[model samples]
Target: MLAIRLVTAPERPDALVLPIRPTGNAEGDGPRATLESSLPAVADELLAEAAALVPAARATGRAGEVHVHLRPGRTPGRLLLAGVGEADERGWRAAGAALARSAADETHVTVAVPGGAPAASVRGLVEGLLLASYRFRLRAADEAPTLTGVDVVVTDPAAYDEAVEAAVVTARMTRLARDLTNTPSSVKNPQWFAEQVEAAAAGEPDLHLRVRQPDELAAEGFGGILAVGGGSASGPRLVELDWRPVGARTHVVLVGKGITFDTGGISIKPRDAMKLMRKDMAGAAAVVAATLGAAALRLPVRVTTLTPLAENMVSGSAFRPGDVVRHYGGVTSETTNSDAEGRLVLADALAYAVADLKPDLLIDLATLTGANAIALGTRTGALYSENDQLAADLLAAIDAAGEAAWRMPLPADYVQYLRSDIADLYSAPTQGAGSVVAALYLREFTGDLRQRWLHVDMSAPSWAERDDAELSRGATGWGVRGLLRWLATLA
Candidate 1:
């Protein structure tokens, strides 16, 4: 974990200065200097020189850049010149990201942005940068270097401290979620995964943690979970984390599909596609991470997280496509495709949560289908919900968080696609409405307890190479912020 610190502008001495010089233009009229003049003064000559060189540092045409300056007899050990491109919020954010990346390997670093920068905008920029530079290195043998501490110097210390503190906490939670998602299945199987959740909730007075192993799952009539996980040597487990604020007004139930690794079972997936199956549990990671963040922030409502953790692998004892499995709530499903198993595990978890915990709202997340990726591409997840208001709230939350999500209709007619000849329903529909079918299948398990429920299909956006402001190349923690924001708005 990185250590963060904030330094006030008055603390920096006058001996340090950042002279901004514009690049791509002639002598006296450079945009860099024009922008720099709008910022607070630096404390050292070397810092001033580096600040002046930012405009000419790079020609990416995107935003600002940062230059490092080290000078003797200065108040601090090193100085950073941050470019304020066009003096806009986006420019400041970009510059902050660049600075964060530059200092990722350092123990401590200071960012000197102009005091005139908006308190909200500066905090947003810093938060965005920290999010973009996060990576999961748990599987690596060598210790990866990371930024330990950051000091953001601002002119109006009292004005920006609250917002900055909020941003820092949010950023830390987002990174924690990303780290869990980015960890490979080899190190994060069902048992280990549940252990991590336990550790996160160890000392929280308001939070309670419980784990259901294979035997306990069977004892509790979680047939769907048992059926899907019976094939893997690693087995299956259910994790339930609850945080209840005293006399809370509203309760939110979150369900995540924790497939530690997926080999596609009998209806196997192609080799190329199977390589990324380690991220199959990204949705679960998001839910756990969001729960931890919400609890840490001490949200006013009660929150419960139910994760069905398992591994989908091929073996002699693995469940087959034609197997008929009984589920919680006395519902039975015939497995049409073993690859479409996330929904099965989630069905049991969701049923247990809705029937047992009885929250006001339920939100289930899974990387359940590739058809969702085909529809939304690699940037957005597909959203389906019975409650229109809940759907709208989630969409607005995603928009505010700057993540992509498209609301999908739950056509009542699609229920016919999942009808099984021998059993009550089929796990996967013969018709090609893959994502919708998966959601519909889970809806059956919810029974008559129809609280506001949402199903997010995050198959495509889990991993990709496209660059963005708040996300990097792989294992994007897409739902962390949106979930947090939504929880913040609940009754």
Candidate 2:
């Protein structure tokens, strides 16, 4: 865990981190100048050394670049140079993450927070730091002790304090999502996930949480979730998280697809590909974290997160292809491919959210379709909504959060893609339009809602193959930042 606080300056910290702007980008001014003015002797040595390095050796002040030095007589002894390419949210966050990675061996560090930028930038920096520092080594043979108690030096106290708290909350929740996603499905099943959430909300006064097991779910006619989880021994669970504050004008409900371990059900994924299936629950983890985050930050919006959890394994009892299951709201969906199970589980939760909860706005995130990755690649997520304004708002949030998202159209004629002779809806057209058809299928359940709905496909971004920029090796926590920004925009 990361322990961060705002302080005037470092009192001999283990490391002194300075956010370095390129010679031109800094306009020859900023924190580096401030540090130089504070200690010209140290500045003389640092500049000379920086200048002596070859192009390949120079830290360049580009995003993801770092230069470390051990200054024998300097104030902090160890000095770190963090590159800030453009000083934007992405740059700042990446630089902060790079710096945090550099701090792995050291516990106490003094970080010079960027000045003059808005609170959003400050928040972004802290978000990166925590995300980079996150490591799920619980199952590792040996784990390194991590950094704790960061001493932040900032120009403005009030802005720093306000941004820091929200940033800290968002960062922790994001890391929580990453942790939940990175965990192997063998140890982290649906029941364990609920127990963790229950533990987290144990003492939080504003949060009300309920985890509905199989018997209760079957009693309530949650056939989709019940069927998708019918194969695994772990069974199925519907995790409902709520944060309701009186006098709230706006209400938002988030539905997430939670397949704890998907062997593609009766269809069955290849053995080699199932290794990363543990991250299929990234959407559920994200929505849960975002809901808890909103409650922690005390946002004025009333939020509810419905996560339909399950393990889609192949068994004699597993739901099979060509089977028709009636979901919540009496919406029957034909399972054309058992691999298309994510949308099946999501259908029940979305219907329940709309029919029973009736929120003003509804958003669902899922690792729903491989076509999403084919269409948008690993760096970008795909979002679909018939409501123009809501789509625009969420895209703006994606931009503001320095994440990637592209809005895909909901063709008026696309309903034909999901036509099913056996049921009200089929999973897909079977060949092309996997992403589009999945969203269109969800539109069936959300048809009667009084307000707008947005569906996000996180199939690619949530489980990336390699580390890039701010995202670590696994469980990038793709939706948390953008969703948080979107919620705050509504607030």
Candidate 3:
């Protein structure tokens, strides 16, 4: 719950954060100049102290290095030097994140924005602070060294007004997603997930939300979701969230796989394998959080989200191997492995979204396969697109937002593994390239599978596995920033 504001020179801070550039970087000079003027006026003494205290520069401004000076009189407490090796958007955010982490014990701080910084870079800086300030202590509010507020000192306040606003929405949504994802599955099942989305949309004028229950899904021929969620006591839900500004020019539909818990259903995972299943719904969480954020920011694009919420569990009534389910659009699919249930639920949502919503571009996010993780690892995500331009656009979004993602081939030849003798398609392939085959399976149920569609196989489950990347050790809210930036680029 960090509060951030763009300000002038009047605000006194607990600590002053200055971005440090490497010796050889061209952009390092301005920041160095700003630091010199902001600090005490003894240059020779300061340089001696810095040489001893700061980390050795490996490259020209290596990222994530921190140097601290205690009780610099110009500031209230200490001076924090954060590294931004080359001063790109990614580096700026890394600097901000690094600064936030260095000042984690402090409640309030002021950061100096370098002279002649771009407005977009300022937004990234703010986002870094806000995101790094996140903690997952839902009940331990008193124990955590949480950041309460931040003041960003900028040379051009007028240029950053809108950028700050966007940062606010992005940061708030990122926290919201983390809060939802960090909550255990005991309290965050499919029904509860749907209710949460409904509650969030309560008073927003530009946002509309609807939740469809198990019976409704069955009646509507969404057998994939219905079957996958049949074993859970909590049942399943299809949560539709739509955000429409009055004069929006384009439509974007987002579908997220909301597998509340992945026990591998009847195909049951080993005890060790089932540990992190609570985070399996992160894709759906991203969609819910991002769409609500769009309404708050009032972006001039119509965004719709179809989140299929379900719990893949084991029971006498659970869907079994070789069971045929009739998905939306009247397409029948056979379940070869119940563990591969994410694609099943996504199948129904994707078809429903594209056919009924008729969006300009269709995107679905799912922690759908382990093969994707094997292909790309936990630090990066896998993105598959049938259209070349859409792939390129999403890659640009990944770079600008500083979220890691790599394009994976959908290779039409991989479609053969999904062929079924009993049904139109099979949920899991018989053999290799499981990630690619999973994407091919989802594309089969989508309307216009080869055009205007993008699929993000977030196999890493959208939570932080390490202490780096300015993210705390919980749900990273990976898609919120990139989706917002991509939506803003529309028109």
lDDT of 3 by residue, 1-491 (tens): 67777776527656766666665434543322113233332234544544444443332355666676786455446767777666676877887788778888877887777666778777777788878877776574558566678888876688899888988788899888878888899898998898889888899988988899888998888999999999888899999999989998899999998999999999999998798888889899898898998888878899999999999999988999899999998999989999999999999999998778888899998888888778887767899997889988887887788888899888867788788999999899778888889899998977664499999988584878766666889788878777877887784
| Cα lDDT of model 2 by residue, 103-196, tens digit | 7888788776645566666676787788777776765476666677577676666767878888888888888899899998879889999998
Clashes of each: 11, 0, 2
Which residue window of length 10 is worst by lDDT in model 2? 32-41
| CA-lDDT, candidates in order | 0.75, 0.81, 0.81
Best by TM-score: 3
Candidate 3: which stretches are off by over 4 Å? 25-60, 72-76, 138-146
Superposed by TM-score, candidate 3 places the C-alpha of residue 157 at a distance from the truth, in angstroms, of 1.6
Model 1 Cα lDDT, one tens digit per residue, 48-83: 455454555542234545565565665555555555
- Rank order by TM-score, top first? 3, 2, 1
lDDT comparison, 1 vs 3, better candidate: 3
